[model samples]
Target: MKHKTPLLDQLESGPWPSFVSDIKREAEARAKNEKGVDFQIPVEVCEDILGVMELTYEQKRTHWKHGGIVGVFGYGGGVIGRYCDQPDLFPGVAHFHTMRVNQPGGKYYNTDFLRKLCDLWDKRGSGLTNMHGSTGDIILLGTYTHQLEEVFYELTHDFNQDLGGSGSNLRTPADCLGMSRCEYACFDTMALCYDLTNEYQDFLHRPAFPYKFKFKFDGCPNCCVASIARSDMSFIGTWRDDIKIDQEAVKAYVAGEIPPNAGAFKGRDWGAFDINAEVIDLCPTKCMAWDGKKLSIYTPECVRCMHCINVMPKA
Candidate 1:
């Protein structure tokens, strides 16, 4: 049989590895001898996949088709309510797709955990998955109305995996890997993520607010996850106690040894780094002062903004 997309085939004629080429390879392999070869996909499914792959301005103008509402029992979290405009055309996918999976705290997953998850999805739903979608669930991309309960049961009872939130609920809380891998962390971000998720299961499954609320936690003021800007509810770990300063490490920084996390000094001045005049000059609160041999903190007025500590990690 000839490929329907001759233009997309032409794109593969060049040296560069086109994504369309990759999609074509997968489609070809599946059509020949693969598990997901023609499993309930639309007649135009290949064209639909290619349409998304090679998008045009006209492709962006898709019809507003999803007007139907659907939900599964015992959960308000996982069901993604939708309907195809022409249900008769897409009978296999007309009801809605469901998403239900427990997110690993700190985004940690063992190989066995991942393997089992994939095996289950291959058995129950479409083999397609998103490692994690924007909402931070292990997205099970396709399923029908009849199988939602069985899917939820197998996930919850057999695998011990809980469902993640959707709709106008508290979505699964996520965070940067805190005390596990980072030295700058003020708290155990992973543990907090787990704690919040478990404690707020009801809230996650129930929509109580006017709009969706998201929770993102960061271990330090560095905010590697950008939680502050994106999440509706953001929490970053901080120090209320005076920052621990190591005088010897300060000496090392001054001598330009620049030990990790203790601090880094301007390497310009060979052995005598200028501490006060240039380094701490522009602190918004002006709460830190470095004497010739020692650093002192006016702890009360320190706003915990992380400006000075970021520069001088050791000291």
Candidate 2:
């Protein structure tokens, strides 16, 4: 039988997709003794999770509480303790602690690795996973307090994986794909991230900081990882060298024979390309000049704003 969840059902009515709907679908499927493509989490766990969510909405406050040290032996961080206040009403979530697994640099993963990791969590956790948390750790959401040690031991011994940082410890370091895929990347971001993570294992596992500290590395000025805005320490790759200019390609762009951004906007009719208006005029330092037949760049004053390169990619 489907339990009453009027508040949660209301979330499914809007245009935006809702997680409540997905959880309810899983709960209903489990209630009917339906087998799941992956290992099935107990139906009661899902229902209780929904029940607590409904109660939270009804009460206008959380039904959860947390405090005190809760982690595996020798490690002082990584596991977050969570408990339900209404244990009698929602027993399944009474000890739904969260664990953070340190993700591989650049988040590279194969199907076989993921399948095995998921199988481990399904057996010991609530079967929900967030690819990355706010700090870029793989979030293993919900597990019993008693199973924490077992999960950690298996995660380390079998998978050769470790937990990320939490509390006042140095939070997990994150990095963009960089040279792995992007042409603009100036350095090996993944390698640096891997080195730093391993080198500072003690700081990552122990609460030595006054507050949480984070490190984020971006391959180039693009800063795809949003390091500047989020992390305490940010590394953005840059070069002192000037950008190369192709005179013939410049003329092609100027004459409207070649598309801007290398025909990236070809699918849409965004009007003719104007190098003077788009590239020269938009330069932050105004270090570019076009004289109909040739293009000139004042490399000494160039800021590497990438405006010229962005508009005339080939040039």
Candidate 3:
């Protein structure tokens, strides 16, 4: 029967590795290694990759049966539970196995570190990876139960990397580009992230909470890391001091001497009046107003959100 994967098949025509072909390789390898074990390329995995379901269930029963709770000891932070409904049918993914590696602050990595990490995981665990999980950990999606400890040991003791948090614990803290690359930062988010993670190692490894909690930091109110929406504890840089007004700079901005937008938007006439209107509308306290060329802020009522300061860096 035809695979009915037109769009999926098209991916093979490109120079990039075909996702289907790769899984097919795994299927072939499984057939060779286990003489009597029956394993078929998972149609669900394929569907997820392409986001298209062209085929129906080939088996009356799939091998994905839910298993018992899955995790490693001493660390509540680094394991995710998964179960196959029909384990007898799918022996490979039978266990609710997950491996979580703590990510470095801000995702800054040298190619050497990446290469070494990949090599270790490939050697000891399943090659499949989520790359990054929702909790911002390096998610090794599958691994054998017997091999989890050894893999983690090698990763930690040898590579000096550690597992992230999971299940009702203080998860690995996350950070946005703070003093590193962004001028808007009021603090060194990277340094603080490292400090917090190291200090809270005990908390990360122990599940002592009523529910999972997360801490995330943003350099400024822009919150490029989605800290406010996603985290239970959100820290954003702000200033309590009054916003300094540079009338000359403001006039220059109004006169179009300064480029309002960067890159392709450079030429667009994002006049001062329009930008000011946008800023004023977003201010919750109704403390902002603009009259074509002049900008006014009710300093006393200002909440020190750093919103206007970030939006218009010149004024």
lDDT winner among the candidates?
A: 2
Mind giving the per-residue lDDT tens digits that candidate 3 earns over 1-315?
123556556657888877567755543543354434322223233223222222213333434445455666655557666655544434455553678788888878889988877566554444466667777788876655666677778888987889888888888888986999988888888888899999988888787898988988887887887789889999898766776778777776667676543223656654454555657788878798877677788988888766666556777
What is the descending TM-score order? 2, 3, 1
Give the C-alpha lDDT of model 3: 0.67
Mind giving the per-residue lDDT tens digits that candidate 1 earns over 45-130?
Answer: 33345543333333555432563445557667667755444445444345447575767776788898888776665555555577
Question: Residue 300 lDDT in model 3?
Answer: 88
- The per-prediction tally of clashing pairs is 5, 0, 12
What is the C-alpha local distance difference test score of each model?
Answer: 0.67, 0.83, 0.67
Q: Which of candidates 2 and 3 is the stronger one according to TM-score?
A: 2
User: What are the root-mean-square deviations of the candidates from the true structure over C-alphas?
Assistant: 5.1, 2.6, 6.1
- Please give each candidate's TM-score: 0.74, 0.89, 0.75
Best by TM-score: 2
Q: Is candidate 1 or candidate 2 better by TM-score?
A: 2
Sequence-dependent TM-score of model 2: 0.89
lDDT of 3 at 18: 72
